[model samples]
Target: MNGIPKGRHSGASKAECRPFLSSTERDVIRLVHEPGFDRWLDQIKATGGCENPVYLAGYTTVQRAETGEILRHYSTENEPGGRMPVRCRNRRERRCAPCSYLHAGDTYQIVRAGLSGGKGVHDSVQHHPRVLVTLTAPGFGPVHRATDSAEVCRPRRNGGLCPHGLPVGCPHRHPADSSAPGRPLCPACYDYVGHVLWHALAGRLWARFCDGLKRCLASMAGIPRSRLGEQLRLSFAKVAEYQKRGAVHFHAVIRADGPDGPNAAPPPWIDTDFLENAVHSSAATGYVQAPFSSATGERKIVWGEQIDVHPIRGEHFTGEIVTPDAVAAYISKYITKSVSDAGGLDQRVHTYEEIAYAPVNPHIRALMATCWRLGALPEFESLRLRPWAHTLGYRGHALTKSRRYSTTYGELRDVRARYASESIGASDTLTDAAWRYVGSGHTPGEEEIARAVSHELRVARESYRERVTDE
Candidate 1:
């Protein structure tokens, strides 16, 4: 039945009457009439369709070639919207909550799989010695800190003060997120070069640390250096986190598997204690020499004095243990974080004007300025500081794992895709398809409806899961 004012449209057809109704009403009617439309709508709601939904133009079909039978048919070009269904980009918090939540879940699963071994790793790895270690940067200068101790903020000896006339120290109990935190106690004394150099050489330092670990293991095992690879192997996954001070710290899950990886076990001689000692020794001694400065004719680099090594003891361990779930969650949480989270810039420095307005700690700003200045010199052109300004002149990987550490991201994605395909009973045969970005995001009205639906779905899911757990 067509609904239109008789005077407005004397003989309007069903298609012609569609234009008169509100877009919302049209969408609602289209959704109601199409078979399986509810399922697609549910998917959209699950994705939390937001303002600026990405529209996809595509086609799909399934046919029996022998009998020329059209078993299934799907084409976006002929759909009501003249395009395939839209999906939320599923970015992290700033982008799309629905997609972000989905991404976080996948990340959690991926990390968990690596730790406990489910996707492809052998289950026996649960018993293998593991550790969750956090390595922090050494003090460049005294910065603000968060503490509950009453002693915080007490006056320094002799009522000492920095050259800048600021108090030499602060004793006030500062909360973790306090603005004062991470500010240098003595800006002049703070080694900006050392801080930047440390970031630049972080990856190399890790490589050196690994090498030292292997050497230490070999010596302890009484095996020839050449045979160390044949005897035992160390595997690890580490994520670098930017501290409030703009310094990078590392959280890593270290495992000792056979040279061949999860399938094989470490030699009996290699114990938790041995691994711990190796890690400590490496952290203490490992260093990466910085490149010499032609202008200054000097070479300088140093490792931080502080290092932490914790044993990843499961239920079998005697002391307090770090659970696999905790490790996975911690690593995954940091994986999505950026330097901006730690009061650093998220984008590269493009112009001098941009540098002035960059929202970063004064110390980080100084470091960036130094990098930019250095980058201008013909001698230091290779550093590419402007492009890496967001990272504070350090261009190392934010997250890195050993080859044999755990299941890979690629493997996890493939498994998930296969499961999704199998759930729908999709054929194994590959089909070539073309898709182009015609547009992105939803209309304001659609976004409002989507947000409401998504919130309700999230609440419902949470309640359901809680009930199941309680039972």
Candidate 2:
């Protein structure tokens, strides 16, 4: 008899009143007691079955096709511990540290491969003329910044106050990490349109910049635009990062490679000087126009005045240059970040209530409202701004690498699978497998137990590793 209320089971004997396991657990136990436990366990492990075991209601077998020889068979009963272990690819740091670490490591390796050349890329390609460039958004308004010179922070020329009674200028020297950094001195004057439009058109602006660079190179080489691709090519990997002021900026590794890609040498004429000129020309002229405002009839968008293009060089050049390693590390650091890193909203805005209650600054709030309003318009249906309101209407990839930059995501997965196979001395033969989302998540009690166990195991492992290293 299962456990029941005192009133309901008053007549049942104590022996019959024993509490039984849950139906789900009983189903799992039944499967574990089946004849094909070994094969079932193997399949479960391969498919990454679960953190908390799931019961299966299926069967499997292997037999000779022609002779019908019962070559092999397995059932759940043969499993050692009555359960299968599996890998969990949880991305949230709060959920699984191991998986998050794995993801970060893959990102680092991918970025590093593009920089120094590894995996499939040729190591010699690291010597190519390259640059680590950062493009910043224009000043929307006067924002507080740390300065060393006495004149830098002097808001008032001769000590005065604004109409609002705020100090005309700050005379004190501020530290770089001061809390007042990035706060607007006069929030009313901020050019919010210029800021939002810059973020929205960042990807398009990059495309135009690349085109300008190619044209600049072609003009210098005295080659036709159509023949430019045949002579040389520009390759790059870039990441978008948000500044403290909630504006998007870019960090890119720009490389000049042959048209044949990383495996081939560039044309003799395409040297560092040529690459530098192309970068400057592109940055100076790259611009994108915003959508025509119904109210204003016409409007224009453009890149900010602030642009940086640093030359990347190997030790042989002996000149000022950004290194490949530094570039890779810098880009990789922002791979896991979101708009939230820059004091912006993290979740989508679905209703007016959510937007009104959002804790972001007034400028960011205005952007969200704009995205929400535009999202409802039939003319802006394609932008899908509402679904991405939290991101301020930008729907481009956060980080993009060129084809020849490094090993691909698919290659990385394959390499990992091959390593696992090698460790088990398994033949590199494909196996057919199928799985479905039967269920997910842990029960409240089970979740608590699992968290505790995971924490204790991590602490023990860390202690052991530290002791070993100290020796």
- Backbone clashes per model, in order? 16, 10
lDDT of 1 by residue, 1-471 (tens): 122112233355548777686665555544446675556455565355443457777765655555556555556665446654454544335556665565566667666766788877888887777777777767677777766656574446667777778877675777776777777777887877667767766777788888988888888888887898886777888888888888888888888887788778888888778888888887887777766776535534445677777776555455655678877877778766777777777667787777777876677788787777666766556667667766877787656777776676577667766675434334533334567767766554456456656676678779998999899
lDDT for each residue of candidate 2 in 99-138, tens digit (9 for 90 to 100): 4444555766777776688888888777777777788777
- Candidate No. with top lDDT: 1
Q: Which ten residues in a row have the lowest lDDT in candidate 1?
A: 1-10
lDDT of each: 0.69, 0.65
Off by over 4 Å in 2: 1-100, 146-154, 158-180, 315-321, 374-382, 422-430, 438-471
Candidate 2 has a TM-score of 0.72
Indicate the residue-level lDDT of 242 in model 1: 84
Q: What clash count does candidate 1 reach?
A: 16
